[model samples]
Target: KKLSRFGVRSKDYYLYLFFKRAHKSFTLLFGCLLPLFFNAICSVITFGLLFLEKQFRLLDILFQIIIGQ
Candidate 1:
């Protein structure tokens, strides 16, 4: 019924269907990756705050060494 309604299903149609199924299956995995990306960004901000004043000599030295600053 669906095939007739949509016309004859071809290889291209099956490929699209498979991709849609795979995307739905990995929804949870995508959700987890989003938090991981934000956590990395937040860590950068927190580090910036702690060292923003150039008060931590050790951290300043490390940053300069790492960043060639």
Candidate 2:
């Protein structure tokens, strides 16, 4: 096969297998953590916004701006 032409012999085949298994687990871990990471980031942003709104009355300012009051 083309692999043989590239000097990838049977002796080194186990390294390829090891890498394949490692890649699979890495992919699975990333897939599982990616959503959790995104959710945590979103929650932090939401809580920060809520804190700012409470402290600064951001919504009241926006309402006043909208009503020209």
Number of the top TM-score candidate: 2
Off by over 4 Å in 2: 1-8, 58-69
TM-score of each: 0.48, 0.67
**Per-residue lDDT of candidate 2, residues 1-69 (tens digit):** 787755666656778888999999999999999999999999999999889879778778888999999
Instruction: Name the runs in model 1 displaced over 4 angstroms.
Output: 1-7, 10-13, 54-69
Report RMSD for candidate 2: 6.3
Clashes of 1: 0
CA RMSD per model (angstroms):
9.0, 6.3
lDDT of 1: 0.84
Which 10 consecutive positions of candidate 2 have the poorest summed lDDT? 3-12
